[model samples]
Target chain A: MATIETPKSQYGQIADLLISRIQDGTYPPGSSLPSEDKLADALKVSRVTINRAVGLLRLSGYVKVKRGSGTIVRTLPVILRDAKARYAARMQGTGAGEVEARQHNLVSNTVYRQIAEVPAPEHVAQTLDLKPGDPTLLRSRTLFANNEPTQIADSYIPAAIAKLSPELRNENAGPGGSYGRLSDIGHGPARFTEDVTVRMPTEQEQQILELEAAQPVFQIWHVAFDAKNKPVEVAKHVMPGHLWQLHYGWDE
Target chain B: MATIETPKSQYGQIADLLISRIQDGTYPPGSSLPSEDKLADALKVSRVTINRAVGLLRLSGYVKVKRGSGTIVRTLPVILRDAKARYAARMQGTGAGEVEARQHNLVSNTVYRQIAEVPAPEHVAQTLDLKPGDPTLLRSRTLFANNEPTQIADSYIPAAIAKLSPELRNENAGPGGSYGRLSDIGHGPARFTEDVTVRMPTEQEQQILELEAAQPVFQIWHVAFDAKNKPVEVAKHVMPGHLWQLHYGWDE
Candidate 1:
């Protein structure tokens, strides 16, 4: 009987080589990788090892394998949230999506926009200290990164405050977005709290983001408070997990 | 014609009531909730509304609705990471699992432990400043929180330093754990960098974590540096995404 080589180390090495190639742009995003037989022969490894390596790449969100279509490199758009930039003096004046677009040299567009007056949902009411069913202005938009739908944000603002600022009701909330309009109305955000969680995308979310069934989504619930520590705005953002990675850093 | 109410608001209200019930312990973990007909009659909502509400809860990881079985409340084991506690003086002395157990008032156990000398994988090698295939000590453990598997951690240390400290090889590192033993041997951690991402679990990972097919996992790669800023240890932790929520906070 032949002795079997350790699978962990061998497969890990193969995966590393493939990842390096992917990182160096040898196989750019949307480009298909070589077949398993070709990789196994070139690397002098068994087909099983090649399969395992590809599997590792799939699990790492580096590549997507399709039945009868071969494997393709994944396009990963990272969103680096520098702790300093997030709370920067200037950033406090603009929306996060606008800042992300400027940093990445990409165009940010509002694909879908809807401004409506509706009953506040329970969570939103609690966050904004409004009675349930109270009238609130709902500004819903689908934000596009480089013309691709990347995130959906739904912002809720008190009807009294929103009605005072006509710009807040427009599709484009001027240059600095809602915060800029809020500042003009003496309700600028002084503090923010964000809660993040990950889960499988809902059917509606998958359709909006055009994601595969297996893809997950990141949900961020953000509440902005005024100088008095009273909540002024609450926004919920849903982003495709496979296409986005959030970066956070802090000094010890 | 009698007007039909909008489904969105009605369903959302129903879901909110159900979530409130779940939160207040009206329906405890692992206990089945009432059927759709019963819920609709009691809550004065349509059956369609109940179905949609239950579906929302299922997607949010609040309850699990099996095919043949009814919907049951999910047991959410929260591991809250306070910013101050994470960087606390004493936490710097112990393992993350130990600190998590203490904070949550739950018992933590090391269910699996293995210490081996193996060739360093490429990523581990790069982080540890070692050549690929260099000898390294791999310490693997599966941690359980209150008798339930919570996380799998794999730590790699240079073989040279690991050989100098015998306590590092033991299943239970005395006192403050591996860092303490490393300090005794002249290699204590000073700084750390952690990168976190989420993805679908592999077959092996699913089995180890005992997760469902749709469940995702969070991967945290940590590199620890010494006083000289040289990497001394690299660790990878895999936690169930549905069971964990990472918290980060900072003041401007």
Candidate 2:
């Protein structure tokens, strides 16, 4: 293994110490960090040095700088997205999302955006086995937690499958979301695969998400396959990376 | 859904156009982008504008600025860590990691680091259902892809299990990694859970991984559970986020 390097600089060393405190609950989340003056006096360092150390913490999403208030430790994510358990729950006709919301004391909701038939992009076409520029059905929505915008999903379905399920063109796809509509058409989803990649958010995404400084966004391509091993729905979800953590579990 | 904002600045517009081209494979991975002068002339914008446009791409990790080769699109991650499939394959006595290494035409290896039995940290103790500062076995290793330092894993085993399996003291825990030795004492893992969070790397982590600018690191807390639903092992993996993509699939 590569040898772990010890921190050299005073500020980096201070930051590491503070991080350990955060991990150990010495400084709990949702609590304000002591002022730079207090910290510097406590650590016997200059206020400027303390400020830089706190800046590093902010950059790492450990803390946030609130206007008119002190630096505060950001709260841990209220929801944990566990894919395997979530799918299993959904398959059984209930789900984990609302249960988590209740557990976290947050409400969940979604807002829809209307979009007309659109041409499939290159990647989407390849995934859905269609030619680029082929017409497809699109469902656009912004999911919220406690009325705060969280994830934006854009689901695309092939023309044939869309025709088979006319509800795909509506604002609501009835109960199980679009999966229920597909099931009605005898193309129920049997399996799902998701690919996740990270990137600095575009200006539009930042504005939409009201993202914090140095926070990144993840683009997840989620493909749903039917029992016959045929891909049916291709959805792309954009989420703020800092506010979310993905969990995966497998039964051996 | 939130309305998408149009790029206001000329440079931002150019960046969006270039990003679209990259997505469409007009500028493929490992390919050089057009020089500032040529792009300025082609788009009728100043060289300064073109430079700023390319800078956005660099920050977003779409491309990297080579010393004299101009900007080059970064190649995609060769390994797709499909969690469900990988776990099943491992249980069946084969795995996806090596198969992906062969397919990507790369070599994979591990470098073991010696770590003495240390007190379980607060989080590890909580996950393993032990008291804080409880003695535990440690396995530290850095996984390499094509000889490049990719991921660092620190696995902690509870004392009882460690005593049950003598090999836990050694660097190599025999065949199926630690899980195999685990099976020897009838404590084979029956389930696994992983929780991931993202943050900027510490100075030492950045040095160890040789991370690029604007890249983030992911901390994954993985736990293995026995058939009786008892937690036995807790491992932490630190990985460069941008160079890796995690895939999760589930059956209904």
Candidate 3:
């Protein structure tokens, strides 16, 4: 049998080897890799080559350098959010996120950081079908999973509806969350759309989510529409990539 | 009205201001930003402050320093893949990705890079409910959007099924592509689960997608199930984050 190397560069080959080790559990998640010098010595490669390989591994989300910890492998998330089950739960006028958190054996809490009627941002105004500078109820929340901040979601609602419902401006929304309160106010959401993207966390997002270096975030723009097809609410959620993955299932 | 500054650091505040300019269309997508010195002079800040602010902006996906283009605002994606629509299209024996590219006035193309029977990886084997090292037919393709590499998708099919279907081994899978061929072979897909996560691209992925610096990739593991709920096919798609976003719609 003949073994032929492909078009990969020398550093690329080294990175692939390191990745296989991680995948095969040699360098399990949350475990630190050996020092670059050790790896270079073992692989008979220069320090520069090992450095490039580690850089690739870092970018590939296999390992990240922590403040106090060395190059630790990324941890696998335990909390898995299924879009289908969450839809069913939310449709029943329940706190779907909290329910899922509980199912994962994690305590879920929503900390209302800010609840105020303010002029909407330009994009938010357009999304909510309001003129720029029109007043909107902004609910800022820090969602905690297992007592740690997991997500920062800022929800925007039309000022009229929010003003009508008192909980929309308070710390607790009583029975269900904000969605439940909205249903009681004749604006029950019938359909939802979640547009998901990814980017490196901003400075503020890093502070809020307590994300580490090289961690990206899932930037989800979620919109809820009433039965009349009118946009009822718009929320932007920023969650750490290491802690989250979005799953969607559909029957063919 | 009196104004009290928030707890944001100096560079953070500057990044926010610059973000506002980008949002307001002052620094439109794909447009190069002013020099660091010029921006510092205009914003009345030191060059170091501007550099830090720009660093934040770069991470946040507002802008990136292209090799020759300098700091250019990230371009908005013209192609939007609605998961629901794609699900329906695939269910009906069609290539949803190609349909979407056509809708966006872009030329969609699939370049088959490799097609062979290989031992399934441990993860792929587990996902497909097969024993480790079992033979699987691998179909590696590079999907092009508007004649540019947009995704590198590697699909794995059980050896038994692939060998039975002749077209599966060929670049041209007759009408409707591989999914259609699978349906014709009585192993039709009945349902699908797409698990999506984001990470920085590997060296190979970066080269294949022709991605710029600091660009992330969406790694989606799509599993197709038969009517009996048995996993039939497993595919791992690596798409440039800037070029794609997954949207899901549901009734709630």
State the DockQ of every prediction.
0.18, 0.51, 0.42
Q: Model 2: what TM-score for its first chain?
A: 0.81
TM per candidate comes to 0.68, 0.81, 0.80
Model 3: which residue pairs collide? Answer: none
Chain A TM-score for each of the predictions: 0.78, 0.81, 0.81
Question: Once model 3 is optimally superposed onto the true structure by TM-score, how far is the C-alpha of residue B53 displaced, in angstroms?
Answer: 5.7
Model 1 scores a TM of 0.68
How do the residues B89-176 of candidate 3 rate in per-residue lDDT, one tens digit apiece? Answer: 7656567778778777777788888888999999999999899999999988888876777788889999988888889888778776
Off by over 4 Å in 3: A1-78, A90-95, A212-214, B1-78, B87-95, B212-214
The 10-residue segment with the lowest total lDDT in model 3 chain A: A1-10
The best candidate by lDDT is 3
lDDT (10s digit) by residue, model 2, range A171-193: 65666667778888888889888
Candidate ordering by TM-score (highest first) = 2, 3, 1
Candidate 1 chain B weakest lDDT stretch, 10 residues: B1-10
lDDT of 1 by residue, B1-252 (tens): 111122336776788789899889998877999999999999998999899888767655678766687887876466764433454443356666767777778787875456888899999999899999999998888878777678888899999989998888887677667877777887887666666677766555666766654467778777777778878889888887777766654433
Question: lDDT values of the candidates?
Answer: 0.74, 0.77, 0.80
1 versus 2: better TM-score goes to: 2
Candidate 2 Cα outliers beyond 4 Å, as residue runs: A1-3, A13-51, A54-58, A62-78, A85-99, B8-78, B88-97, B212-214
